[model samples]
Target: AQTVTQSQPEMSVQEAETVTLSCTYDTSESDYYLFWYKQPPSRQMILVIRQEAYKQQNATENRFSVNFQKAAKSFSLKISDSQLGDAAMYFCAYRPGGGGADGLTFGKGTHLIIQP
Candidate 1:
């Protein structure tokens, strides 16, 4: 069974600052995928970042980036220059690397507090 865990239940950062959220996972498969999804107060699930198992390079999207350590089985998300709109519940999820086994397993979530 693959499991994703976000150790930080809540995190706060000042506006325009950067914050890194910790996440770890247990997976036996050599090939798999990880993703970070953000759900704001609106209750919409938005894809923040995604990292492929085979990719040695980390993934970055604007202010969002991921530190993917396949060897340590850890994946962390870094949000740089966070804004007030970035405040939300961030969830880290895992998906098996196979074509048919793409179902996602999600962590509880980390509530991000954006301090003005």
Candidate 2:
């Protein structure tokens, strides 16, 4: 079994600033995939970034990046130059490698607030 945890239920960051959302997971699988998803007011899950457990480098997509510490089982999201559009419910998710049929295991989510 795998589980993801987001300690902060909500987070706020000023416009043009940066914010980091923390996530930790427990899994027995040796190979897996970690992802950060954003769901805005539209209620659609958007894939922000993804990191493979076997990869040593973190994943990044434009202004969004991840700090993946494999040994620590920690994967945190860093949003740079925060904008109002970035405000949403961020979820950390995990899926096993090798095309496992199991769907993504998600965290409780962190609601991000952008302060202008």
Candidate 3:
């Protein structure tokens, strides 16, 4: 079984600053994909970033990026130039690479607080 863990239950960042959310996972499968999904108060899960286990380079999207350490099973999300709109619950997710696997295995999630 695969599992995702977000150590920090809550995180806060000042506007225009950067904040990193910690995440770790346990998995026996060698091939898999990691993802960071953001859910605002509206409750829609948005894909922030994604990383493939086989990829050496980390994945990035705009001000969002991931520090994916495959060997240590660590995948963290970094939000740069944070904004008030970025406030939300962020979840770390996992999905096996092979076909026929079920949906994502998600972490408990981290609630982000943005301060003006």
Candidate 4:
């Protein structure tokens, strides 16, 4: 079984600043995928970035990047130059690499607040 944990229930950052959301997972599978997803007020789950456990490099999409520590089983999201649009609920998710019928396992989520 795999589980994802978000230590922070809520986080706040000033506009144009940076914020990091922490996530950790426990999994027995050797190959898996880690992801950060964002849900705005619209309730849409948007993929922010993804990292493969076999890959050494972190995944980045524009100002959104991940710090993936495979050995530590830690995957955190870094949002740089945070904007108003970035204010939302962020969720860390995991999926097996083998691709199964089971859906992604998600964290409890962290609500990000952008302070102007």
| Best TM-score among the predictions, by candidate number | 3
lDDT of 2 by residue, 26-112 (tens): 999888999999999999999999999999988889999999998899999999999999999999999998864869999999999
Tell me the TM-score of model 2: 0.97
Which candidate's lDDT is highest?
Answer: 2
What would the TM-scores of all predictions be? Answer: 0.96, 0.97, 0.97, 0.96
> Between which residue pairs do clashes occur in model 1?
none
Q: Which ranges of candidate 2 are over 4 A from the true structure?
A: none
Total clashes for model 4: 0
> 95, model 2: CA deviation in Å?
0.3
Off by over 4 Å in 4: none
- Candidate 1 versus truth, CA RMSD in Å, comes to 0.8
Segments of candidate 1 deviating more than 4 angstroms: none
Writing each residue's lDDT as its tens digit, candidate 3 over 1-116 gives: 89899999999889999999999999999899999999998999999999999999999999999999988999999999999999999999999988786699999999999999
Go through the candidates in order and give each one's C-alpha lDDT: 0.94, 0.96, 0.94, 0.94
RMSD of each: 0.8, 0.9, 0.7, 0.9
Clashing pairs for predicted structure model 4, backbone only: none
Candidate 3 has which clashing residue pairs, if any?
none
